[model samples]
Target: MFSRTFARSLTHTRPSASLSRACLFYTTEAAPATPQLLVRIKADVKDAMRSRDKERLAVVKGILSDLTYLEKSPQAPAQVTDSVIQILVQKSIKRRQESVQSFQSAGRADQAAQELKEIEMLKVYLPQAMTEQEIEDEVRRVVKEQGATGPKDLGKVMKELGSLDPAKAPKKTVSELVKKVLGSL
Candidate 1:
C-alpha cells in the first residue's frame, strides 16, 4: 500500500518551470572570487605541472593548501588579499630558514641546500624588501612623528611603524634601527 501511494504521488506531481528555475538558481555553482594574484599563482601551478617542475609545483601547492586551510578557519578574512599572500610567504621563508639552520648544524648540506632553494623560490612572491637606508629613514620618521624620545618609547614607535608598513620592514632590522634612532634623542 505504501509503495502504491508513493508511485501515485510521483505520477501526479510535476515540477513547475518556476520551481525548476528556483532550483537551478540555488544549485548552480558560483564563480570563485579569488584575488588576481591568487589567480596568477594558480595559473603558475598549472604551468609548473605541465613543465614537470616538481619543486615549483610543490611550493605553489603548499601555498594554495595553506590558503584553503585558512579560508576554512572561522577567523579568516572575508576576502583573501595579496597582502595575506605576502604574509604567508614570509612565514614560509622563515620556517625554511630555521630548517636550513638545523640541517647545517646536523651537517646535512644536501638538505640545507634544498631548503635554501625553496626559500629563494618563495622570496620571489614577496614585495621588494626595504633597503637598510630606507628602513632607517622610515624608523627616523616614525620616531620623530610619535615624539618617541628614548628607549622607553620604543614600543610606541614600533607599533606605529608596523601600521605604516607591515610587510616590507624586517622586524629585527626595524627594532635595531629604532633603538639607534631613539637613543640619539
Candidate 2:
C-alpha cells in the first residue's frame, strides 16, 4: 500500500532526462500560421496605403496584379500553393534584377536603386534561401543516396534534389553545384 504511494511520489519527483527535456522545449501554443503570399502582399499594400507610401504600394499592387493575370489565364491551377507563390515571387525578383542591370548600364542609377528597393519588397515573400554550404552538403548526401558516380548521372541527381521542398533551394545555383560535384565524381 505504502510502496505504491512511494513509487508514485518517486515518479512525480524525477522525470527522465529526455522527458524533462521534451517538456522544457515543447510548446503548448500553436505555431504561428504562415499566410499565403497574396494575403501578405495585400496586407502590405494596405499598410502602404495607410502610410501614403506610393513606392511599396505600387510594388505590392504590381504583384497582386500579376496574380490576377495568372488567375485569368487558362492554365491557372485549381489551387494556389506556397510553392507556386514562391516561384512567382522569384520570377518577379529576377525580372527586376535584369532591369536593375539594364538601368545601371544606361546611366540611370536612381532607377536601378528603385528597382533594388522593389526587389527587396518582393524578397520578403520568398522563403529564406539556403546557403551554398547547405546546398553542397545536401547535394553530396543525395548523390550518395542515389549512387550517382559520374557526370552522366547529373540529371538523376538533380531530379532527386528537385523532389525536396522547392522553395528552399535556388534551382540555378543547385544545378551549377550538381555539375561541379558530378564533374569531380
Candidate 3:
C-alpha cells in the first residue's frame, strides 16, 4: 500500500537494501523495494493532517521532523537506513513512556495523558512486539545453540541475541528473556 512517488523517493534516498534490511524485517504484505513501516507512517501523517486531528498531526509532525533531520545529517553514516528509523521510533516511545511516568508522579495527569497519546501514535509504526513466551523460546534456542550453561556465558548470549532478527522477534522482549535466562543460570 505504498504510493509510487514515495517508493521512488525512498529508492533514491535510501542507501542499499542490505543495510536497511539489517535494521528491519519486511512482512509478506510489504512492497519488495520499500519498507512498509515508513510508507504507513507517511500515509497516516497525511491522513492526520487532512482530518485536522491536531494531536496526531502534531505527533506525526514531530516524528517526521526527527526523521528528516536524521536523514540529512552528514554525521550519520551512509549505512543509516529505515532500520535506523525503527530504532529512533523505539527511543521516542521510551521517552514518551518516561514522560508519562514522570508526569503522573508529579500529579500532572493531563500531561501524562498527552504523552501516552503520543506513545500510542508512535507505536503504530513499530512492528508488533513479541510476547514474553516467544522471546523466552527464542532465547532458549539461542542458549542451546551457543551451548551457554551459566551466567558467565551472558556475554556470548547477549551478542547472539543482539544480532538476532527483531522483525522476527522483538528486541526488547528478547532482551528481557536474556536477563531471565541469565538469572536462572
Candidate 4:
C-alpha cells in the first residue's frame, strides 16, 4: 500500500525495513522521527557497538529503552507520535545536563565528559536551536502581538510564548528571551 516515494523515503542506509517504516511514518505525520534523524541515530549506535564504544552504546541503549517503555505504556494511547518522541528527547537532554553538573561537582570528570558526549549525540536529532538574537526577536514579536507591557504582564507574555511549538522554537530559549525582553520593558 505504501507508494514508491514513501518507501524510498523510508529506507535508511542501513537496510532495516522496520526502522525505515517507523522513521517514515513519524516524519510524514510531522511529529518526530525524520528519516535523516533515524538513519543517523541508527548508524551511530551500530558504529558504537562495532567499535566497542561503551559510552556511546550506553547512551543509545538508554534512549532506545525509553522509547520502548513509552511504547508499552498505556499512557501513550493508540499512536506514539513524533511529538511524543521529541518530548522524550528533550527530557533525555535535560536529564543528561543535570547528570553532567552533578558529575562535575562530584569530581567525576570522566563521567561528566561521557554525559556531555551523549548530550551532543542526542542533540543531533533535535531541531536547530534558535540563537539568542533570534529568540529575542521572537519574544519581542510575541510580546507586541499580545500587547504586553511592563513586568506585571510577564505572565501573559510567557503564556503566549510557551504555547509555541518547541520543534519550531524551543520553549526554554523562548522563555529566557521573553524574560530578557520584558526586563528591558
The C-alpha TM-scores of every prediction are 0.75, 0.75, 0.68, 0.61
lDDT of 2: 0.86
Task: Report how far off residue 12 is in candidate 3 (Å).
Answer: 36
- TM-score of candidate 4 versus the correct structure, residues matched by position: 0.61
Span of 10 residues, lowest total lDDT, candidate 1 = 161-170
Best by TM-score, which number? 1
* Cα misplacement distance, residue 71 of candidate 2 (Å): 2.6
- lDDT of the candidates, in the order given: 0.86, 0.86, 0.79, 0.78
Model 3, 1-185: lDDT tens per residue?
99999999988885779998776875667444555666777898899988999999888777778877887888764554566667778888888999999999999999998899889888877766667787788789999899998888878998988866555466767766787897787
User: Candidate 3 overall Cα lDDT vs. reference?
Assistant: 0.79
Of candidates 4 and 3, the better by lDDT: 3
The model with the greater TM-score, 1 or 3, is 1
For all candidates, the clash counts are 0, 0, 0, 2
Error of 4 at 114 (Å): 2.5
lDDT of 3 at 2: 100
Model 2, 61-122: lDDT tens per residue? Answer: 88778877887899996767778778778889989999999999999999999999999888
Ranking by TM-score, best first? 1, 2, 3, 4
User: Which candidate would rank higher by TM-score, 1 or 2?
Assistant: 1
